[model samples]
Target: MSYRSGFITIAGRPNVGKSTLLNALMGQKIAITSPKPQTTRSRITGIINDEAYQMIFVDTPGMHEGKHLLGKTIDKLAVNSIQGVDVVLFVTDRHLGKSETKILNYFKAISTPVILVINKIDLLKSKIQTDEIILSYINAYPFKEVVPISAASVTNLDHLKEAIYKYLPEGPQYYPEEMVTDQTDNTLMAEIIREKILYHAQEEVPHSVAVVIESITPNEEYNTVDVTAIIIVERSTQKQILIGSKGEKIKKIGTAARRDINKTLDTKIHLSLWIKVKKDWRNNPNELKRYGYQDE
Candidate 1:
């Protein structure tokens, strides 16, 4: 029997369903997802172990133009993750445009085989339309295999998995069989909190907010975990928006985040949130490091 195992990086533009595709592939949520652009700010690794192979998937921040220091750091993180991987899953949708040319050029410099994953085929009206979109990519690069899938609907994912497995080289498992992701509990909790803020708050609030879990205490007898976290914002007005009138908005955010945390941790959750104004923490190197956005 032959075994296959290797690292695979998923790279694409923002809001292209990169995180959604990752959740579907893992059959669980390891990365956070929201309708907002640039939802993913770090590199998340999900592992799939089966009798035949172990596929390590790296879900990276979407490659884009950086408008600020934080944005630049995230873009760099996504780009750096592509190298040194056994394969690359370049995910994109039907709305292919000139901005994608830069990404294609990046792939040209890498020796790794890239599976051009044309995601969100469900949006297309017909097979002909789908083929037309795929052709544009085909003309640009020598993709090892081009697989069209709707990551949201879990459509054609089996074929995507098959394509990945076919290209993976034989090797030993990189993680334990029971392990699904490399992210720690704190990171997941903070992300869940951030995800809720992205969903509940107004559009502008999502980009300004960053959640940092200060402490997590587990009560074995109660089968519950209590979490304390700080939500960092750039301005005092943004802080007011997050906290809301009489703390109603914060309460709503906590309720939503706690529900998801309970499911992820398989325990009762008590989440405490605090809003703090950091006055441009994104550009401050020390603050960025404190918030877990480190340069590679």
Candidate 2:
């Protein structure tokens, strides 16, 4: 029997459920999700392996105009991820807004097969509206396939996978079956911590916050790991807000992050979180590089 394997790049504007679709397809939570936009900051690869095929999915940061050095780097990552892929999953909601149109225009020029995945159908009121939305996209481009799915509820995702497989060529698996993601444990830890901050922090704090794992020490005798991370902010006022009165806010973020890390590590994790002011780190190229925003 012939085997099939390829890379599928998930592209969309910010907060359009790209991360949610990646997690749902993987059947596990490798990429972190929050209600905030630009929650994903890097090019993370999730592998789906089975008896007949291996589908490598690249979950990229949302495509949006860059507001700072970090934002520009993220936008570059998303654009770069679209290149040299076997298939591109252009994910969007029912609204064909300007950003979505821009993305569609960009994808139209790419040589790889582009599948229009209209996500969030679960939010639609009726099938007639879904059909109308599908028709609008159908007229926009000659897509290999147009699939409507609800990435949130995992509805119709199987059909989407089938649509992707239709374009995949027979090839060897790029990754081993045991490996599910390309991110290191340290990077994953930092992202998990950042996810907690995005979930708990208020206003602009989520965009300015960057968690750096300074150390991950293992205690062999106690079967526990000590994780020391520093959360970088732009100003002292932001630091004070993150720390909260009596350090309550930071404590809450740490507690939630620690729980999630413990589950991932399957061992007792001692998470030590600290706050620092970086004075517009997002705009500083050096600071963005230090925070692991450099392209790879």
Candidate 3:
């Protein structure tokens, strides 16, 4: 059988379930997801290897209007990811809006085929609602395929995969069959920690937070990994919120993060989390670079 492989970029606005779709498509959780907006900060590559094809999916940060240097950087990362890819999945969970229009404008300049993926269809009242959404986007731009799916429920994903496969070009496998993602262990650990915060933290606190793995030491005697992570926030109040009264919140975040890391990385881990204040770090270019957001 002939082999096929290509890169597919998942582009969308904030909180539209793009990351959830990526995780569902990969059949594993390489990408961290939450109900919060701007949860994804960078491009995450997930490789799905089948006997006849290898589909490399790049999950980009949500595209949105930026209020700070970090937000603008993330928007730029998402826009740039759409270029130089074999196919683009413009995911949206609702009808035409300002964000979708801005994304469609970019599609006009690029020749790459884009598939309109209407996510969260399970939330719709009826098939007519889904059709209305499909009509709205199709009228705005010509999509190669329109597939309505619910990423959270894992519905219609097989159909979506088939649609994606149709656009993949014949090529060699870019990654090994056994490999799933391109992210390093430390990056994954840090992201996992951040995901926990997003789930536990509320309001602006989650958006301002950044998690960095300080060190990862393996102990052969106990067959466990010792991980120390620092959680960065923009204000002292945010730190207090993360730490909570008597450190309860931080403990909850740490415990949840450790559980996920142990399962996802398939290794026992002793996780230690610390909170730090870096006043308005989102606007500080140096701080953004230090947190691995500027260089990308």
Candidate 4:
């Protein structure tokens, strides 16, 4: 196939720094990152513009073994995004152990060409160790390419990009050349808020929380974005934790989130944060559909 534009999905276990890697490739932070596992609850698509090619990268939630309503839904979304893509980049950390084996078992037989991306090489401390880890991945799967890099430091990513071009199917551009992402402005606002909350809270609270942008009003002085986002949770206790005593914790979250919103929207934002008991929204099929977690 001639050089063409297409989608490339990034798949890997949680906390493997997949989101961090996507931001490096795009040279901007489009997806939210957190230290907590399963920080990414939905599929995020970013557009890469270059003179020779236009590649759309899809950052997916980490893969895990579970049957819970939310886990099943998240895994399904990650798996579904890989279908019909030009290439699949499967990332894994050098510290990764058995979990890596489990994730590969699912994709080893898939038709899409899999690129084994060994990330976090900066922690390897030696070139010989990195080489050994690379060989291990090669022996495990019939990968299209074996590339090592550190997403945090943006190392060796050019080789990974070059590997992707070799397998991309020839076709027309899927997005405008000047475009960077397909995410809506409103969605971007919500994600920015969510990113702040995640960075501040980390694993102290679950990362399953979702952010919704209720309203935005543009004015000469400043734009007041009235956001009534529900911090969805599986239980009442989690709701209490998010709300905090006299709402002090959430107040901090709101303050931090507002700062990011103001920068993204180019104006002051009045963000109203609220917590609601969704009763396991992740597992509830009806609730999931309503929250835009339905099958795509």
Candidate 5:
């Protein structure tokens, strides 16, 4: 029996359901998802290991054209993830907008085996139009394979998985079936808190908020865990919004995040969250380095 394992990257524009698609494929929430653009700032790994093959899928932040320090740094991270993947699943939306062309142009310079995934087919009122959208991409370039799938729904993922494996070079399994993600517990916990922030906060706040776990101490005697985190924001106005009137907003964010943390850890959690303001940290090189977004 031959086993195949290789890297596959899900790269596309923000809010294009890239992370959601990876979660669906892995059948677990290895990556966070929200309605906001760039919810995933890091390259999250979602592993799908089967008996015959183990497929490692990387979900990267949306590729946007921005030159701001933060934007450029994030863009660099996204582009760097493209290298050395066995197959690059260039995801696109059926709801092609003014920026769709720009998204397509990203692949024009790539040399990897590009498999165009036209996601969000569930939203299409007419399935017959799938051909035209597929053709639009196919006409642009000779894709290895073009497959349409609804990432949010458990629709056509078997086909997507099959299409992914078809391009993967046959090899041995990279990881055991029990492991699903590469993110550590600390990073995953921070992401869970950040996910809650994105869910409850306003549009701009999601992008500005960063959760860092200062310390995590488990206590068996008290049957609870102690966690301290600092939620950093870019501006004072955002800080005010995050704190809310007498800190109701932060309270809500804490409740939502604690429940998830408890579930992830399978224990009672005594989580303490605080907020801080760092003015224009996104553009500050020092802050960017501290935030782990710097190029090494």
Candidate 6:
């Protein structure tokens, strides 16, 4: 059989399990996911290598109406990512809604093949319900294929892979077999820290936070790494929420983040987290750029 390779973009509305589907397809977590909307603010690439094909999947920020400069920039990133990809995976958890319709409109202008992936089927009650959801989307647009699967449960994903492989062209491998993602170590570590905050912080605090790794120094004497990270928030009130009473909340977040860092990076390390208030940094273009949210 001939070898096949191509790029696929996972596009969807906020909190529709696009990131989860990407992680499941890659068989590992390269993107951070949370119950909160807009948890992903950038494009994350996950690569899958097999004997017959190489699939490069781009997990993009959820497309939505923007309330700030940062939101608007990331929304543009999601829309722009669909262009030039070999296949587009349109993910949704429910019937056709306003957000899904808006994304479908963008498909009308592109020639790229799109597969409607109805994720979170594990939450549904019956097969009839799943078919109803699929009919709603297929009626709105002619998708290349319709797949129903639960990303969290890893159900029916092999079928989805076969469908995606059908569309790829016979080509050489774009990346080495060992590489699974394009994200650097610093970016991955920073995102892992932010994920902990999203799980622990409440209300608007999670959305207002940005994490930056200042320094990562190896301590050869102790065979460990010492790392410093700065967490940026828009207001002092948000910082207080993260810190909690007697510094308990921040401590919990740091501990959880450190644990994951050790497992993901395969190194023992010390992590120090500092919270700083930047006062509406999301609206400031300079601040957005400094926090790694700028347009490429």
Per model, how many backbone clashes are there? 0, 0, 0, 1, 1, 0
Give TM-scores for every candidate, taking all chains together and pairing residue i with residue i: 0.97, 0.97, 0.97, 0.90, 0.94, 0.98
Return the lDDT, model 2, position 196: 95
Scored by Cα lDDT, where does model 2 land?
0.90
- Residue 202 in model 2: shift from native, Å? 1.2
lDDT of 2 by residue, 142-253 (tens): 8899898998899998899899998999999889999999888889889999999999989999999999999989888887888899999999999999999999999999
- Model 1, range 1-296, lDDT digits (tens) per residue? 79999999999999899999999999888999998989999999999888999999999999998887999999999988889999999999854587788898888889999999988999888999889999888788899999999999999998998999988999998899989999998899999999999998886778888899998898788777878999999999988888899999999999999999989878788888888999988888788888998545
Q: Which ranges in model 4 have alpha carbons more than 4 Å from their true place? A: 1-3, 202-204, 219-224, 264-267
lDDT of 5 by residue, 1-296 (tens): 68889999888888889999998997767788898888888888989878879899999988887566887888778878878889888888764555666756666677778888888888887877887788766666668988899988878889988888887888878877888888888888889999999989987888877778899898889978899999999888998898899999999999999999888757688889988898878788888777666531
The lDDT for every candidate, in the order shown, is 0.90, 0.90, 0.91, 0.79, 0.83, 0.93
Q: Candidate 3 on 1-296: residue-level lDDT in tens?
A: 68889999999999999989999988888989998899999999999888988999999999998898999999999999999999999999898988789989999999999999999988999999999989888789989999999999999999988998898899998888888998888999999999999999999999999889898898899989899999999999999999999999999999999999999889899998888899999999988988999525
**Model 3 scores what on Cα lDDT?**
0.91
Top TM-score model? 6
**Model 1 poorest 10 in a row by lDDT:** 93-102
Better of 1 and 4 by TM-score: 1
RMSD of each: 1.2, 1.2, 1.1, 2.3, 1.8, 0.9
TM-score of 4: 0.90
Per-residue lDDT for 152 in model 5? 87
**Least well predicted 10-residue stretch by lDDT in candidate 6:** 287-296
Q: Which ten residues in a row have the lowest lDDT in candidate 3?
A: 287-296
Output the better candidate (5/6) by lDDT. Answer: 6
lDDT of 2 at 293: 93
lDDT score of residue 54 within candidate 5: 89
| lDDT winner | 6
